[model samples]
Target: MGMGRRPAEADTDPFSGGIFNLNESFSDRIGDYLLGSPNLSLPVADETFSLHPFPVAAPLSTTNQETRASNGHEAAEGYDMGISEQVSATCSCSSQIVVTFEMVEISLHLVTAPKGSPGRPSQAAAMNIEEFLRDHKRALVSCEMLLGCETCSCRGEYVMLVISICRKLLHSVGVMHREGLSEVQNRDSSRERGGLWKLDDEDQAGVLEVLLKIRATRLRRLVTILDHVVTSHDWPAHRSMTQDLVRRLAEA
Candidate 1:
């Protein structure tokens, strides 16, 4: 009879279920699974467990060597590893980024005195100029309403209103003259080059021309009315006031 084959050894690896040794106690198998047997290589087994730190890791020098070898760089053999470590340390310490911003305001048409020493306008003077402009505009509107009113039959009241508005307008003009803004001395200078006030000379001239035409038309109307009142004997009390209004309008 042929020799019987030697019995196969039992599988001792805890990873494999102990099927060869069915008589083994459950507690014994569980203890071996938790503590591991001497036959098992702990380093190799540790690889299967991810929660624990690595049993063996590559050294920094070795990793750098492998990187240099793989990259085929111009670094010479046995290059100092401290250089890379120093660079990494520096970058880690001061890696933050910062930015800065600033805001400024500028004006092109800032007003200044025409006759005085070249200097910026004072706050009070600027406010006064603005007030004058506002008052002039208001007076012009008031005079316009008074002149256009047809319901008011009293010509004396009309003359008084017109005279009051004209006085306010003249006062504003006086203030402007005192502020060195009414008639700038360099008004006849080259249009290409001028101070801040003269920068928009052409536009101002156009506006002034239109206003002058309106004034001439209004004066013609006044003369016609005055002529009619003079020739007619009715409303004799209104003659003097009408003449005074006419004179004020002409002066304005």
Candidate 2:
């Protein structure tokens, strides 16, 4: 026995109250619409996968690296050039040399007041007198010795002049000693107005004696120096002048 075919409405349009179109293929038309849609063609999956965007950097080439190094070297060379110029200028200034010379001067004065005078002698004053006299004596002795030596360049006339000066100094010393003795003798009368005790005649005489002894000692020293000058060497050219100076000093 053969099977029977379905009814026409049931086979053609069951969902639309049994209505159907017979000309088009539905599955093929749906496939074509999906391929042509603008929304479906966009890359939505790529945008959704990455939430943050990042910038990409390119790698440096060898030529660019070399150019940077050369620029740095040129900058360093310019800095060093300035330093070198400064150093050279400093050296030039230091190369110049300078020298200087100085001279010194000394001055001395003698004290002639008696020890028994109104005012007592200061220790400093006494020391200064001694120092001055010592230096003066040393200078005179050295000059005399130099004149005596044959190797010395000093002339006989110069020695004679120096001896004359010494004689004058000795006269001045004598005058100072006499004044000191007179001052001691008169000091008592001068201080009487102040009610100070007057020194007795014996005391005055003792002070004068001391002054005389000091003068005698100085005279002896001067005579000894003159004798040394005369006997230490022979001055044939200045014999008469030397003798005259010696005679004058001895009389003083």
Candidate 3:
């Protein structure tokens, strides 16, 4: 191909003016807006995170200090109260446990209490007998005193005397069936039983006369009980004693 006189010139930047325009530097217009210097005019950054001069926190005001102190004191007081409540709860639990254990002990003791031995008289029964013996002896003594009074005209006293003597005779015979005669004899060594005379030979007639006037039924009942003691098992020491006492009363 035949060569032309010249080829077309290379494309050039209009802003650069020409391809050899090396005297002007390549200035970035966008970089000026994106990465500006510190002195650039713009809105201020928040002081909280700003580290240019190392952020200095603002000092607390007087009101803020007082509020913080009050909050700390309240927290300490609450802690102390919590400790006291915990201790009280612990003490209450301990006391309840102790009381429960004591009650259980008492219940067990009651359930397992020992029984009294057989054949032996209970303490309460023995006390009752002792009281009865003393009272019976006293009644006999009072009847004997009334029989000695020749001037005493109270019909009630003569009736009580008759009843007392009959009761003693019957009791003397009855006691042998309950226990050995030896036990009664040993217990009543100092106290006279059926042997205690209600009336002397002279007084017997008067006592019998007074009893007859009161009621024939009462006198017959007494004679019947006395006959029973005197005739039955005539060899027993109590029976012999009752027989002697009955003989005196019947003689008049």
Candidate 4:
């Protein structure tokens, strides 16, 4: 080698190669852009990951404070997401390649302050929320296969999106003609009544403790699901669904 020789300059980023920031849009984030999503068939969970949401035997409790916080919710902060059912996964040694399955929640909890801001959960809202959460949890889940990085993340985003939409439906349609404290109890007669429902804690604290631990496999499932949505152009159909969810959650 010659002395004082300089190294050659590369034209692309090491992590992303030349693909970084080439496309910019919600759709791009999910599919055809850097994610390389199929750009088709992402609505149904079945076309991406192999696992789909399944019904829970019993409804998980949402009366606890810590749990609410982990879901990025606060009473003053408005809407929140709770883990009504966290999905779990396993690995298949049978293939001799260490394939994995993801564990995530098939169900969620959406609590609404019926009487407006600072309103305590009324009998009805509480009752209704509980029932609604359980019913939605019971809805079946399914999935397909996928293979990509950004596409995987897009899949996760879509999964988050669908769940968000479902929660919004609960608030607007789940409890109608209900407001304030009365709303809470009537819907969830089983909830421990007459206690303060605290709503000011960061997510990932003690909030997620009740559910089983999340793993990469489960996250993989999420990515796969979102990728399907992005590639297949399901966002158009999911537009209102996700928008409503964002609106309601933002209110809370």
Candidate topping TM-score: 2
lDDT of 1 by residue, 65-143 (tens): 3224457642233234435455334321111100000000001112333333244354433433333332333334334
In candidate 2, what are the lDDT values of residues 1-252, reduced to their tens digit?
Answer: 121322121123222221122111221121122222222222221132111111222221212121123555332111222233343333221111000000001212234444444333553443232233333343344334334443221223335544544554455456545544454455444433211223454555453444333333443444455555555545443455546655654565
Give the poorly placed runs of model 3, Cα more than 4 Å off. 1-123, 126-132, 153-157, 180-252
Highest lDDT model number:
2
Worst 10 residues of 3 by lDDT: 24-33
Instruction: Choose 1 or 2, whichever is better by TM-score.
Output: 2
TM-scores of the models, in the given order?
A: 0.29, 0.31, 0.22, 0.23
Rank by TM-score, descending? 2, 1, 4, 3
Task: Please list the residue runs of candidate 4 whose C-alpha ends up more than 4 Å from where it truly belongs after superposition.
Answer: 1-130, 139-180, 183-241
Decoy 1 TM-score against native = 0.29
**lDDT of each residue in 93-210, candidate 3, tens digit only:** 2222223233333332322233243422353333222233223233333333333333221222233334445544334323422332233333423332232232332333332222
Error of 3 at 183 (Å): 6.9
- For model 3, what is the C-alpha lDDT against the true structure? 0.31
lDDT of model 4, residue 32: 17
TM-score preference between candidates 1 and 4, better one: 1
